[model samples]
Target: MGQMRRRGTVAAGIAALVVPLTAALGGATPAQAATSCTAGVGPYQKQAEKFLGRPVDGKQSSTDCTSIRAFQSKHGITPAAGYAGSVTWGVMNLMNQQKAAGKTPNKAGTCPVNKGRIACVDLTRQLSWIQDGKKLVYGPVPVRTGRDKYETRTGLKKIYWRHKDHVSSLYDVPMPYSQFFDGGQAFHSVGVSMWNPPGSHGCVNMTKTDASKYWSLLKTGDDVFVYGRKPGT
Candidate 1:
């Protein structure tokens, strides 16, 4: 993803997070925002793939449903079971943001190991992992990602801090590992995601259990890998 050609200035609409590319959506004609499961699905799926690092035909996985539910929970939204809905749109919006940031999932799935420790994100599969020496840890958590061309970043990153049971807004958003990248993208956990892969605003969301587990195991500068639909070998 490269610097998006903005048609207008981006505005802060939803979440406190705002980027320039989002400006295009803000000015999109009503007809453009309207999504049809037919074509709109592609943009959503494509953006998700950018994060997953592989083509995960959103229609081919139950994880898609699980991911949508997770999105609903994040924004104080309730998730419905089965089928993509309005909530899914919001998730897509987040994914689009990554593209705005010039971090779409490219073809090469190679995230360098920086300083002997690496925190990598795989956009196509929507998964994140941690590596320490030869040890690898994984979690198939829900994420609210950036849009089509705007996807979560993938590269050698680092974990700079950890927050346990951190309070966010009205929810106790627990960040297991706060990996320092651009600004505030952390690896955390929440109490949602009915077992699907929702998008994240760059931040990685783990299960409540995994958040706590990683909280104890993860350390600053430890290697982290964000790839796959689920954390795996």
Candidate 2:
């Protein structure tokens, strides 16, 4: 077990990767843009799956489409036909909308940290700390933020679940000791090269030392806080 710590002050700061979705559409043929046969050969399925946490199998076979469509509608983007062709490509170009939704999957103060010696995230300082009933246990280590078009998540919340060494195809990074609080987001590790302000894939990235230290101290139901945005914009 690790040493316990007290809750500290938190501020907002940010980081992450930028794969442009429009580029995917500009290269596709016109025919591929309108045909929506569901499933197979399209970016929609892939994007939707990443958004929904399940396989779409070229068909709207689950609540996946509903979730995807809801996200798209909420952001005022046309939902892809669950395919990877032209339509999917076109919709993807408006990924800023998707990225924004990814940031606020849960409302502020919706997932408050239960007062029982949990973890906390300070987005402004790009730090994560583990506490033990007002005492410090883990850290205040340096972390990275979202890059590309992705925006790292923020707001008041606490971790409810954790996964050890979780890998994701969508985020394309291995989240060591993944702490899932809001939908599809977690505490994880990214390449050291991404050490600047915005060098993550939406989730906050931390150094091995900080992550390992906190990993040992943190349990499932800990308090986690998030705030801040990219350094400048």
Candidate 3:
């Protein structure tokens, strides 16, 4: 078994690609299939339909529920009942925004340009990337940051430590490519999907590939600029 582990489950993150839902769903869609799903119009029915490419009629239908519920289940959202509530819509909304974020996510100039070889973490977009004096060095990949009470602190920090096979001292979970920059908070790879609900315990969770890339691209004393407030936080 791989050492990588999330606090809850791995089915939603990288492992999801290994298990295709095609055969089980009769080739419907990994994110839009099921025999049973919630019924009735949800609070964000129209918005969900727009995001999922479903017919944009405000009323909820069986097909819409199936699609929405599948998306919920895919992202590890609670209920997975296709309610199209604020929580579900919120996730979809962020995804839509991310898609709109084209080549330059830092075009807003929020991250410091003077910092050489710095990692930029935008909690509002739930994305992270590296830059070398205005030039994009690495990815603008999705990430999972600390939620609610355990919010990831916003400010500039430096990677103080690293451990390839680090295990969480408090949660007892494997945190691969762990790079600590703040107290109990690091950029590590977890099994949970970046879009998974609630969030991490004040750590910046990445995919194994992303974390590995980050590990190779970043080093001790590398500046990490974190800004913006995560929605619902």
Candidate 4:
């Protein structure tokens, strides 16, 4: 599976998915002021400072705000207001765990290795990747999956449809690079940060770049294995 484009016939007559009114729209909550660092010390200021390698003083300094804000912005933490609250702190913790995984994200052997070409989604860590046997094909990029009641269904499935430029019939939001692997719970690129809270209605949300890469790399019938439970949901 050396980057070969395997074209397969698309499944026709698949019902257009209508997600819940709460959140099928990918860009429903865009962080507009992600760059503006606020002026106050957050509840987790000291923890954030330590995580960012800044001074361990509990007070919020200008430099600390800027650094914490940068981390929040980079990870798509909401408000992006430079506050080191629990959400920001939680994301920092996740990043630390992922960093420890390094190049071999599948070291835990959760994802099936025998599948020729498969998409591996680790909902527990909110990360995804493409693999060709033992070779890592695409990324172990950060992702946003379904929230609470609409949790992304786990188990092995195959890509049944591919809609490069898709708009939700119900939500009317753009779902770019949409590839339906499990009913309405497709893999699509959204406009918000992958770390955005409460997650999607059911879809696996990816960044624009990551979704585009997946669209180019995978095709209908490709294996998609979603495992583990998302942190909150």
Candidate 5:
């Protein structure tokens, strides 16, 4: 009976070792694997296509993955790892559904005033756009404007200065693609995650890619309209 008990104990020890080894060899579990954007036909693929401004075909293509990565990067989606997984799908779904429901801007009054080219910042929506007459040239891209005490000034102003690489003397921070409109306040690229917000001092913060695009389109003397109070004042 004592000999039998010892054999059983040895068997149990081997079983425990086997389980962990099998798990390690098998790699990520189903739940962890599901986080990657697999290439194939699926509803998530269709949603990702739509979010990327591609046709919603329910089929995954290389273009779709690239665009998804771009969107993920812009929105500060992590693993920013170019996978349209659960988190990516969730963010895209929420934003796309909201846009479909007309929560996004179609037009702003200031867009038509310039007639040539203008950048309009809608504080209420935390969105910014570039327009020429009635034609939208660029965004409805997300932005982080100044918070309460340092509220970004309202009213129309013209781009008076631009620096492809600028450093803030006052704050001692790098402000790449800085386009100054209202005094010290400028539209510049920020490296910090803009997803969960604290807010900027008095500048308009954009992703580096968006800021570069802005620099390419806007020149000195371009009109910039800062209007609408941020939601909840």
Candidate 6:
């Protein structure tokens, strides 16, 4: 009788564990599960895929969203949460439209200088590019320029200094991958939303990824041109 009771107790315990395990297994999908973006095959997807070096199949598959997020991360888009929503689509569309119009995809009118390697900042377009004469090296990359009160100075300048890991003496903030051009202003990586309203304070903010790339492509004394006004000015 005692043996029978022990067996029954063990069976009950095993059943309880099994029941909860089964329930958990049947619960909602894991957070790491593949995410399917619903934006579908459209202009946004087409351009995004092209930008991401993916096949332009016009399908918003899980792979597409992943590639879009990768691009977002490179260009300073906030969240980089793998969703090609309004901001992502808007930027991509603008780039595509510009390309279709036979203009430099990210050029704000024209190249500020017509010479050697230069970093071009078009505040009007909130985009930056690195070019060697007329040959494009990188960009039309989304950037955040200074806000209204502390507007980024517009004119031709040159990168006079560079700091792989710099800290602002006035702002008391870290400025990584900093390349100073005008006064205390610089082009550096900032952890803020590039698409949002309130902008930076006399600085050209880029994504960490872009900043790193810029560091590699530019050197001290490289020409830096700040022109045009930011969109929605």
What RMSD does each model have against the real structure?
A: 15.4, 15.0, 5.8, 10.6, 19.3, 18.1
Candidate 2 lDDT by residue in tens digits, 63-131? 444444333432334444433444333333323332332233222332233565765554443445555
Q: After superposition, how far is residue 131 of candidate 3 from its true place, in Å?
A: 0.4
Ranking by lDDT: 3, 4, 6, 5, 2, 1
TM-score per candidate: 0.42, 0.47, 0.86, 0.76, 0.58, 0.57
Error of 3 at 226 (Å): 0.8
For model 3, what is the alpha-carbon lDDT of residue 40?
66
In TM-score terms, candidate 5 sits at: 0.58
Q: Model 2, 38: alpha-carbon shift in Å?
A: 53
Q: How high is the lDDT of residue 17 in model 5? A: 25
Best by lDDT: 3
Instruction: Give the clash count for model 6.
Output: 5
lDDT of 1 at 194: 22
Total colliding residue pairs, candidate 5: 0
**Model 4 segments more than 4 A misplaced:** 1-43, 69-81
Candidate 5 Cα errors over 4 Å, as ranges: 1-110
Candidate 3: clashing pairs of residues? none
Q: What does the lDDT read for residue 127 in candidate 6? A: 71
lDDT, candidate 3, 105-203, per-residue tens: 799999999989999999998888889999987767778998889899999999999998999879889999999998789999988778898999899
RMSD from true fold, candidate 4: 10.6
lDDT per residue for candidate 4 within 103-149, as digits (tens), equals: 57788888998989999999887778889898877677778899888
Task: Name the candidate, 3 or 6, with the larger TM-score value.
Answer: 3
Q: For model 1, give the 10-residue run with minimal summed lDDT.
A: 1-10
Of the two candidates 1 and 5, the one with more favorable TM-score, higher being better, is: 5
Q: Candidate 5: minimum summed lDDT over ten consecutive residues — where?
A: 1-10
